[model samples]
Target chain A: MSKAEKTLLNVPKIQADFPILHRKIRGKRLVYLDSAATSQKPRQVIDATTDFYMRYNANVHRAIYELGEEATREYEGAREKVAAFIHARSPNQVIFTKSTTEALNLVAYGYGLKGPIQAGDEIVGTVMEHHSNHVPWHFVRDHKGAVLKYVDIDDEGNLRMEQYDELITKRTKIVTVSMCSNVLGTINPIKEIAKRAHEAGAVCVVDAAQAAPHLPIDVQSLGADFLAFSGHKMLGPTGIGVLYGETEALEATEPLLGGGEMIREVHLGRASWNDIPYRFEGGTPNIAGAIGLGVAVDYLTDLKMEAVRAHEMEVTRYALDEIHRIPGVRTYGPEDVKQKAGVLAFTIDGVHPHDIASILDVEGICVRSGHHCAQPLMERYDLPATARASFYVYNDSDDVDVLMAGIRKVQEVFA
Target chain B: MADLRELYQETILDHSKKPRNFHEIAEADASAVGHNPLCGDRVTVYVRLRDDTIADIAFVGQGCAISKASASLMTDAVKGKSRVQAHQLFQLFHRMVTGKPGDPVNTAGLGKLAVLSGVSEFPVRVKCASLAWHTLEAALESKKEIVSLE
Candidate 1:
């Protein structure tokens, strides 16, 4: 087959891997454009979790039976796979949490509260951060007496590097930002920002919830001291998230929760903590979810992150060109498709986002409409909300066409 | 099974485009703000009451077409009604939009408000249609707290 033919053929084959893509909603073929919120799991990921429960379902680490040993190996093997996926220095740096929100909180409390952040210290974040990354720092600022400064974004939703340079200073103990903005889809310069933060004696944290599923992530190359992503936002199940911290960074922080499997020796007066990753994981982890996430990583690896990214960029370029053809459609994010992910947040003139969303819903086109948990960003732009349509592996130009048709329907209904 | 045309009727579209009584009441006796954090819809209801009767009513805010139209309809419905009558109408309107399984919906007194009965089909939009009424209730009761349909 020709290269173009091969690529076009792979799109349907990729769609086949995701079972939910075939389902109908509201009697119309489902056009899921909200993958940035949470991606539909592939059959491989689903089967991995089901297989674990069906074959070897036992408590990991505590029990000494054959089933227990198998479960432990599978859980730890998942960690190793995730470590390799992110190119972490070792598997011991990967801490499992419920979601990206919890993972970010683990760092905010475990690292910030323990000692890294002190009274009057400054913590820098961006205006484009999702609430998951924003709210945790608010707690640190409110309780720890640290000053929280937000770097502004330009009209194109690109980070204002001048303001960012001013925001990060010697007193800045930590600088946290999202690798890719969930709303604007701006691909941030994490490696450059990490270098700047390091030069200023600040540890850089990255919220990779949006980027991990789209871009090729290398923690070592990115130089982020701590990185976090959710499994559900990728192709894995819910209730499983990864927090990849540098070995030194993980060792320096305290555990957020205290319970079984997290401690080495409980002396009644003072308890000794377990090793790096286990110490952060306080209780019985999400074994099934972890295994599922492992399989998801394997699946993505087989597809090749580069190819996936290329496909998304192609789809995004097509969407941008087509969506712009609709008069009165104002899209947010960089004009250059290369600078952003497949996510597109936009507003139709004279139409409320909720109304747009409802109109699209009738056509079985799922798009997120609201402030998108980034109220501060919404306030920054003086907008109530925006209708966001995001693309993923299974999505193609046809899905974008359906979305355009739905949007035209919204205009007609409102007109 | 829900129809979009039913939700966005002709009267609704008209009211949403040129909402009635969509200005601030300068000499307001009672006023309260209603906010729907989910969709960022906000409505401020103001009432100038003469004894128990609403002498004048107005609303000022930004929201979706349904919410803006509902607010406009609500102000027109409750303007001349007494406090008791307005409360009763609020209850009727609420039930109509919510479509409570057992509640009786009497639309005889609801003129333009009857158009909003279609909101019942779209359960998620009930909050949008009732935000103004909730604020009106709070205003009539002279509540100082902001009304939030969380």
Candidate 2:
């Protein structure tokens, strides 16, 4: 075993922190391997959310009551936690949205559609982007007449650097790419890509929905003008996400929504927007979800993000080795473990992905099957769908054993 | 694993591997495409209706065993039946797979399709078993568009 393999986290202790892991599925122990879709929440995060609703349930940023003050403090405190988690320059840079989809749309519409993007200008993205990052750019292309370009990925699922370099030019107004692909598990060099985009005088947007959970992200070092990630994928509650933008980028982009919380002063005809983050968060926000996410951030911090990444690397390596031993199994993504996260996308020759998923479910294993919301990427690979098994902090080698056993059973059934 | 056997019966597996009437009618008078966006399952149903009587039916697509086998059995079942009879069979098959409460399984007319009665045990897969039937409905209605099961 490698040194990295020896440093794997204490899986039994971490798995115990998640209450859902204790439950049985179909009279069998549940082996969850679908963290990319959404993570199982830890007890600490769940208790924090319940604590908020039970103890201090009040509207924020409006009322002057003591309960209101406490609510606002917790909400704002969560924002600070997110900022520190991502190494954002300031808490104000972290704008809370509903999910990564809404965060990316905010950037696409607030910045790309409103004005900055002109007709015939190019907006570049990778072919491997989830629909959230890809479709919004299509909207910009169709409505604004901005030409959209895609950087292609090789058969190994690595981004072709030459194509990426060729796609970004002086006419490129914005370049949005995922820091880590949800399907292929390929981790791109965000700092290098951001530098290239900056040299071309274009803003770089990082879709960190899959990256934020497994990787340590520093917005300053990454050189990203804007970054978006979801809460549910990182062991937090749903309906809460973060969008980190440089102060100047936030000031330049218009607010996507107009409501009570996002406005400073309103007149009959015109209304001035609030400050950077406040201007973007409209209406009564997801207060409980934010507090829960804050607790999740604290939990991850306690584990140390570096340790989390190392653990995932070890588990992914073990999974890759075990899966390779299975006949007729073909895996996608970077060959090197360092170039990927915890996702393992594969196909069994005779059995369809859905069938594999179904058989796996019978064994109390959860895996995602289908296009993974990246139809364009699926088209590029000429594959209808794939079965994906993703790992998280709580996963270990034992979970991989169950997954392998399930795959072998599927092959036997089909054979 | 026993429940899984019921879902993927030997007949279903055989048909999925080599589905009967699985081809594109180059001169199909009526054809419609059905797509399940969630699983990327797509099936295009083609039919030749002569004097309101089904003369021929065929399908071509890629999907799971359940869906492909379902399509194969559907084409075999509805190839010679009239338009009205095909519609009745579609309704019966839908109810059988969906397991609508109070609606008992009526396999009196359904032949090979009775094997798929176990589909109700897996609720999420009901759509997979019904994709081809839905496309056949669209083709019969003369709808000139893709049918999306969102």
Candidate 3:
């Protein structure tokens, strides 16, 4: 079989791996299209976590016993897996945190607030950022007296590259952007943006919370100084995330939290810090979550990131084609599949998004309806809220048909 | 497990379609804006009080069907009631929507507001049904801050 055909055929097999897909919702078959919020875990990911607790449950990096050594090996092995997944220079470049929000805050506080940003320096960001990426810079601006500049997007939800170019001047200290919009699903040109930031003598921070699940990332080629993403959004467990920083950037950053593991030597009121990644992980980390995330990375690796991207592209293309057939429906983001990802944020005239979500819920179709944590982007488009359907590997044409039918039901009820 | 019919009743659909008293009151005595940061639903409640009695009430804003219909029905039900009675009604309505499963729904004196009893099943939407009532209470007290159910 052709590579494309094999990937398409794997959709059903992927669906079967997620045990939650077998359950019924409201007496009907479940049609989960909210992968952007969080992906359902497969049995392999679940069992890996369960096995960690049942067999080798011990604090890592401290004990010298057998179980403790095993736990430390698995935990560090997960960090290596994450480093390889993003093609980081080394495993020491990966730092584990609680969530994507925490990972971004680590960079914003550790790097931005420490010494890099001075008073009157400029921090350039885009309007398409999720709160995780947007609000942290606001803190830098508020506390450090740094200026914040936002690059606007076109009507099609594509960031204006010319405005971004103009925004990055010699005085710009940092340039932060999302690799893909959580709401619009517009894939940005991060390599070009990172290169421009570097040319202007500014550090580049990439928020890959949305991109890491759907796209193949090569940090070396992307030229980002730092990147962050959550494990839960990528079919791994919650409460664990990764921050990938270049060696120079990580060395310059100060630890946000001061605790046991982050210190090399301690005295009364003063201490020297540990190495790069260990210094960032202050406390005992989410050991089981990291192990499970390693299993998830292996799962995605076996499936091939290219196959995952192609499957989502096909599903999103099919959705875009059929969505135009429905009257009074307005969709956000770039219409071209090449420029967009799998998220579809839309509004039906004369019907509010909350009501639409409730209606879809009755049909056992799970969709996210709100600002999607992108209130700035919502305000840019003058929208109160929108109902969004995001796709993933387990979703296929059958799920899209169910969503289309459910939307018709919403219209008929409102009519 | 509640059916959609129980929540989006015909009266609710009608009121949501053609909401009554859905306009700003000119030179109103009291007004307050209520915001639900979750869904960006906002409603501004205006009240004209005459000696502690609600002489006129109106609201203007955008929200889901439940909120708009609830605001519309609230204006009609509390127009002639005193401030004390309105507060009592608000308390009763809040309980009706936020009641735990197996808790008896006390719809006494709730009248048309009883239709929102189905909101108890949808815990996430209770704020949508109660946003206007919270705004109305703020307006009655002449509070200056915007009411928020974040």
lDDT of each: 0.90, 0.92, 0.92
Q: Model 1: clashing residue pairs?
A: none
Which prediction has more favorable lDDT, 1 or 3?
A: 3
- Per-residue accuracy of model 3 over B62-93 as CA lDDT, tens digit each: 99999999999999999989999999999999
Q: What are the interface RMSDs of all the models?
A: 0.9, 2.0, 0.9
| TM-score of predicted chain B versus true chain B for each candidate | 0.93, 0.94, 0.96
- Tens digit of per-residue lDDT, candidate 1, span A1-415: 1112234327788889989989997788999999999999999999999999999999999988999999999999999999999999899989999999999999999888875789999999999999999899989988899999999999999999888778887899899999999999999999999999999989999999999999999999999999999999889999999999998888878899899899999986899988888999998999999999999999888888888888888888888888888999999988787899989999999989988988898899999999999999999899999999999888888888899999999889878
Off by over 4 Å in 2: A1-7, B100-108
lDDT of 3 at A74: 97
State which docking tier applies to candidate 1: medium
Per-residue accuracy of model 1 over B26-124 as CA lDDT, tens digit each: 889999999999999999999998898999999999999999999998888888889999998888788788885334445767777999987887778
- Of 2 and 3, the candidate ahead on TM-score is 3
The residue ranges of model 1 lying beyond 4 angstroms of the native Cα positions read: A1-9, B100-109
lDDT of 2 by residue, B26-112 (tens): 999899999999899999999997988889999999999999999999999998899999999999898789884234556666888
Q: Report the C-alpha lDDT of model 2 over A1-415, residue by residue, as the tens digit.
A: 4323475577788989999999987778999999999999999999999999999999999989999999999999999999999999899999999999999999999888995889999998999999999888888988899999989999999889888678998899898899999999999999999999999999999999999999998999999999999999999999999999999888889998899899989999999989889999989999999999999999998898999999999989989989988989999898688999999999999788999998898899999999999999999999999999999998888889899999999988888
**Among these predicted structures, which one has the highest DockQ?**
3
- DockQ of every candidate: 0.75, 0.63, 0.84
Score chain A of each prediction against the true chain A by TM-score and list the results.
0.98, 0.98, 0.98
